[model samples]
Target: MVLERFDAIVFDWDGTLLDSTAAIAGAIRGAAADLGLPDPGPERAAQV
Candidate 1:
């Protein structure tokens, strides 16, 4: 019903509607460490 009423729907949650930089950075760092890789640290991780 909702889809039929609207031709399209958009969601803006990619750091614009909501900021998840810290969480995303942490996940990246954790993944790297899980593989025995060096930690990029907060700075580098944020850049990524």
Candidate 2:
């Protein structure tokens, strides 16, 4: 089979082009800590 190409590609922000994983995870961990829960760590955001 052959491959195809597109004239251009589009992506959404807040995830597609940014590695906000650390920021997101930090927020989650902070929230969890505030609520007396365990910090899931930045890797958890990457999984999501």
Candidate 3:
């Protein structure tokens, strides 16, 4: 009962244990800034 590609399963779909939206949004903003592009802002970043 083990998969070679994965070590564990995640069960945080409801954001009770973890919330990756902010982190992902920050990364997107950082990437855009790195490329000399305007920031999409927190609202746009989190939504789109």
- List the candidates ranked by TM-score, beginning with the highest: 1, 3, 2
Candidate 2 lDDT over residue span 1-48, tens digit each: 999999998778666778677777778888889999877777874565
Clashing pairs in 2: none
Q: What C-alpha lDDT do the candidate models reach, one value each?
A: 0.90, 0.78, 0.87
Winner on TM-score between 1 and 2 is 1
Name the weakest run of 10 consecutive residues (lDDT summed) in model 2.
39-48
1-48 per-residue lDDT for model 3 (tens digits):
974887788786746877888998999999999999999998899985
Provide the lDDT at 37 for model 3: 99
> Which ranges of candidate 3 are over 4 A from the true structure?
1-16
| Pairs of residues at least 3 apart in sequence or in different chains that clash in candidate 3 | none
Better of 1 and 3 by lDDT: 1
The root-mean-square deviation over C-alpha atoms between each candidate and the true structure, in angstroms, is 3.3, 7.7, 5.6
TM-score of 2: 0.53
